[model samples]
Target: DKNEKIYVSYDSTNKNCKAGDIEMAEYGHPKNDVGAPIINYSIAYDMTNEKPLLYESYPGSIVDVSQLKYMLEKIRGYGYKKIGFILDRGYFSKANIQFMDSCDYDFVMMVKGRASFVHGLIMEHMGEFESKRACSIKAYRTYGMTVKAKLYADDETDRYFHIYYKAKKQASERARLEADLDRMEAEMDKIKG
Candidate 1:
């Protein structure tokens, strides 16, 4: 199904221009301050819903967990509880994850490589599945469970918990592709010359 949608990005700086402010040039005019004095807003609209839900916003360069929690609470007050929170890689910190866990919220967060250090306990358990030819890992926590899924590249059905093996193979394939491309480019240059 196709639906028509329009989105607006709201900011805190929308001020009306007065003749005196324009003439005096001391207070910034409306043109100078594009959207001043308004609250920041992000909204996602579903045609089925009677009203749009305000999903996200960032007032400044950095947003702390407290600011996010306040924004979410305000949104939840409007009767939107089934919320999915998303953040850029810059906001991928241990403190933020802990906050999410404490608040009993589910989030789809960008997992930066460095953030994996927080899951060192999981990494340490990798060796337990080394001998198994095919396996998957399931982790239990007081809150919920995590499943580390793996599948074979050659055969989709043949999945295993060989983390190191998969990572090394992927890297090797990438290196091989780069080498092949370099060789092919050299050949192309020779033919052109």
Candidate 2:
């Protein structure tokens, strides 16, 4: 009913609960990074007003990805005529994307660097990218971090992928990958010893 642009962010928070005190509380990876009997409460917020739209609690063991279906349905029930969703990387998946597309919802989610298909696409188009500031927002960020974006239509899935590149992020990702490999090798040696 409102004319203002609608945006929502999906996220979760985990909290420790006492035994028999909170229903659906069980062991899962704690967002606090502490091993405890915690329950995760997944919440969606209307970004414009920052109001809570819907929330669902799951066992501590349930991963965030598995809860997207439940949360998506809750948002759809809100009956928003025109709205766009902004979700974090953890919520990105082919199945989730397909589901959202099937429901005819507009969403923006970042595909992870580890996704092989996205990686291949990036490699295929990396050379075609030329440095440019398309608009004011891009111009402002260009001094520190330059961005290049391209839109590609996927005929197989009937989906379109808008891939963005940041020079800083690309360099950092390479360094991070090398560090991870070194750390893994060290851990493996310790395990063998």
Candidate 3:
């Protein structure tokens, strides 16, 4: 098992909790409901074993982007070498990326599609691999292509951007957008009346 690549998925969620002796249970941005004390719970999950490797609790006021360095240090302290990370969009930030790069850890992070750099990449590479059978990932039922570039202007390392397209997901998202637009239009008409 030591020779195998270790991949961990890191994510966090807020849970409503009573603020008694627990100092971390403070009111912050609640993911579920507003105006309640919450505690942030994060987990590092072993992707290969399909189980959690570790969990940590932190103040709800702390954002995900700020916790990456601390979590990475803790993980490394556990004697895990040759580790890779699968991170969510909330953890995507210049500082976090740089910290990970400094530690020399491999990671795949979800980038916001609306980010200018990401949008530009999508526009530049649009339609290049979507219809190609060779680009299809059968297991995920999606088409994917990779782009290599520096994340920062002065970075010594080249980062790879894996762009994927799923037709079913796109159709579902479009339907949701249309429904939302219809509802907004009706609300505006009622307000005008």
Candidate 4:
């Protein structure tokens, strides 16, 4: 929980991990997507109130949550207790949710519209987003730190999106204007005039 004052961090990658040594005969053969080579990385943080700790590294997908569960369980063996797994949208999945629930752990994760339908439901309530000064307490109670943030709605989809925005902070306003100018120039270039 943000109110709990805990540690936070992230994991990412710039290159793909080698799937495996290719067989001499399989050099150009069709390959499994997992065997097609995807980037692999992970992040771990110590979410013990006030103090922050973060660690990240490349650990092939095979050692992912399986290793994570092993490590967390071992930590419990050494006597550590915790709550909620916070993760990026890539790590969100029905299986992950079920695993966490079964293990008595709560979590916070961003949902990607490409991966799940939950994002659509969230979009439905975006117009009623709570302001920075105003929050829907009852919604929080029901959704567990989840709230529909008021963001731009898509005209075709009518989907609401929550986004972080500076309230007219000058630096950001200048940046937005610069981006707009760039966009206009690009549009002008595309025209047949």
Best lDDT goes to which candidate? Answer: 3
lDDT of 3 by residue, 1-57 (tens): 644678999999999886567788887878887677889989999998888989999
Candidate 1 Cα deviation (angstroms), residue 59: 4.3
Query: Which runs in model 3 stand beyond 4 Å of their true positions?
Result: 1-5, 19-21, 48-51, 176-193
Clashing pairs in 4: none
The Cα local distance difference test for each model comes to 0.43, 0.70, 0.88, 0.46
Compose the digit string of candidate 2's lDDT tens values, residues 171-191.
Answer: 798999999999999999999
Better structure of 1 and 2 per lDDT: 2
Q: The CA-based lDDT of model 2 is what?
A: 0.70
| Separate clash counts for every candidate | 7, 2, 0, 0
Give candidates' CA RMSD values in order.
Answer: 14.1, 5.6, 2.9, 10.4
Give the lDDT of residue 116 in candidate 4.
Answer: 31
Question: lDDT value for candidate 3?
Answer: 0.88
lDDT of 4 by residue, 1-193 (tens): 3334333333343234454662221211121343454444444565565343433443334434344554335434544444556666655445555555565555666665443355555455554443433533453332112444322332222223343323345467799999999999999999957
Deviation of model 1 at 9, angstroms: 17
How high is the lDDT of residue 88 in model 3?
Answer: 89
| TM-score of every model versus the real structure | 0.37, 0.67, 0.83, 0.44
Candidate 4 wrong stretches, greater than 4 Å: 1-39, 49-79, 113-116, 130-193
